[model samples]
Every structure is written in structure tokens, then in C-alpha cells.
Target: MLTTKLGVLLSGRGVVAGDRVRDALADAGLTMRSAFTLTQLAAGPVNQQTLIDLLGVDPSAVVTVLNELEGRGLVSRQRDPADRRRHIVVMTADGTRTLHTVEEVLDKTDDDLFAALTPRERDQLERLLTKVADADSCAEKY
Candidate 1:
């Protein structure tokens, strides 16, 4: 189906975009793992388990990435005041700086990738993608 092909193509584009952003971040002395973890933290302080769930990564993988980030002094983990059993992950000032750099990289990647599309086409694509994402989220509630 054409729609299916489009979907696959979009996924491939996403992978390419991610790779480009990763490389840019790496050149800036930031790892893809740390950038991703900090992006999660940017939403707010969250537990390791929640980050694992959101990223769809294994617990061990999440732990390893978090540990590396901690070692880099980009992230800090602390016991949740409300629940000592849970660890809250927060980004440090260094992490925030890295996130800003990552954001710039992602912006450039998006601009380059979508440059082929006209402004109207880009607007339509964004609207359609937003609708699909919203639908998926709504479906999850059922």
C-alpha cells in the first residue's frame, strides 16, 4: 500500500535524522545515550523505571546509560523525598547545556531533511503527523 510505504519511509527518515543529530552531538563531546537521557529529564524529574518505560529500553540498559551520565557529571540521581524507595533523575547545568546543543543539532537536521517539502506541504505533513500521534495516545487510554 502507498500509505504503508509512506509510513516506512517516514520511519527511515526518522532514523536518519537521529543518526545525524547523534553525530553532531558526538562532535560536541556528547554521547547519544546521554543526550537522550537528558531529553527525558527535560520533561521533569522522573524515576529510572519511568524513563525505561518511556524509552522502551531494558532496565539494565537504562541503568548503564544513567550511570555513564552520572560519571560524566551531567546528571544526578537522588532518593525521592516522597518515596525513598524511588530514585529521581535530574539533569545538571552541564546536562542543560548539552541539551541546548542537542536541540540545535536536531533543528538543523530537521531543516535539512525537510527542505525538499514546500511550506504548505510541510504544514500539512505536520498536521497529519500530529493527528496520528494524538490518535495513538487516545487509543492507549482505552
Candidate 2:
């Protein structure tokens, strides 16, 4: 069957897992994209273009996400001092708390999703996935 193909199986599982994680994030009033953005901003402030690069999404898409986060008081954007045209993005205190909450949500979701796998198997899967991801030239775009 087509599902037996490695690529097909991997794609199917990836979609399902991504959906599950997105659902969990939604319950916390965040999108997967927004959560990822918050995680990046948690480290330090970065300009909008940097987010556009890191997210591997269109500049408009990054603006939309930033708009959403700003509306929610989860992030703020101010003009970059070095570049008047660039806007620096930073996570708010609420954003930091929300990021922590989503991290816990993701941890729980991962546990549930991989319950069928043993601890060793889970570790192996992570390593294998990382290896495959690292090998992908497309991944370098992000």
C-alpha cells in the first residue's frame, strides 16, 4: 500500500503530530507559528527581518504573526535604533509566561504522542529525525 512507503508514512505521521501539537497550542491561545516566534524572541530582541529569515516565511506573514502577538500583548515591536526602517521585536512578560506554558503543553503532547515508543526508541527516533533534518538542504533556508 502507498502508506507503507517510508516517505508516505513519515509525511502522514508528521501531519498528524503537527496537528496534535497545534491543537494543544490553540487551547492556550497561540498558534504554532506564534509560539515558535515567542520562543525565538525569548532569547533576545531581534528585528522583523531576522524573524522573517528565522521563520522561513514571507515578510508579510511575519508581519501578520507579529500583529497578532502585538494585539495580544505577547510581543512588542519598536524601531531599531541602528536601522530606522527595521523594527525590533521583543517578547513581553506575558509572552514569556505563555511560552513557558506552551513548552509544558508540548512536553505533555510529545509524551502522549510517543507513548507507544519506549524511552530508548524515543531517543533513537529523535536522533534519526535530527539526522535526516540536518541532511536536508531545504532546512538550511531556515
Which candidate ranks first by lDDT, i.e. highest?
Answer: 2
TM-score, per-candidate, Cα-based: 0.73, 0.89
User: Ten consecutive residues with minimal summed lDDT in candidate 2?
Assistant: 133-142
- Local distance difference test, per candidate? 0.80, 0.90
Candidate 1 global TM-score? 0.73
Q: What value of lDDT does candidate 2 attain over all alpha carbons?
A: 0.90
* Candidate topping TM-score: 2
lDDT of 2 by residue, 47-127 (tens): 988889888878887898899999999999999988899899999999999999999999999999999999999999999
Candidate 1 segments exceeding 4 Å error: 1-4, 11-15, 130-142
Residue-pair clashes per prediction, in order, are 0, 0
lDDT of 1 by residue, 65-118 (tens): 889889988889999898999898988998888788789877777788799999
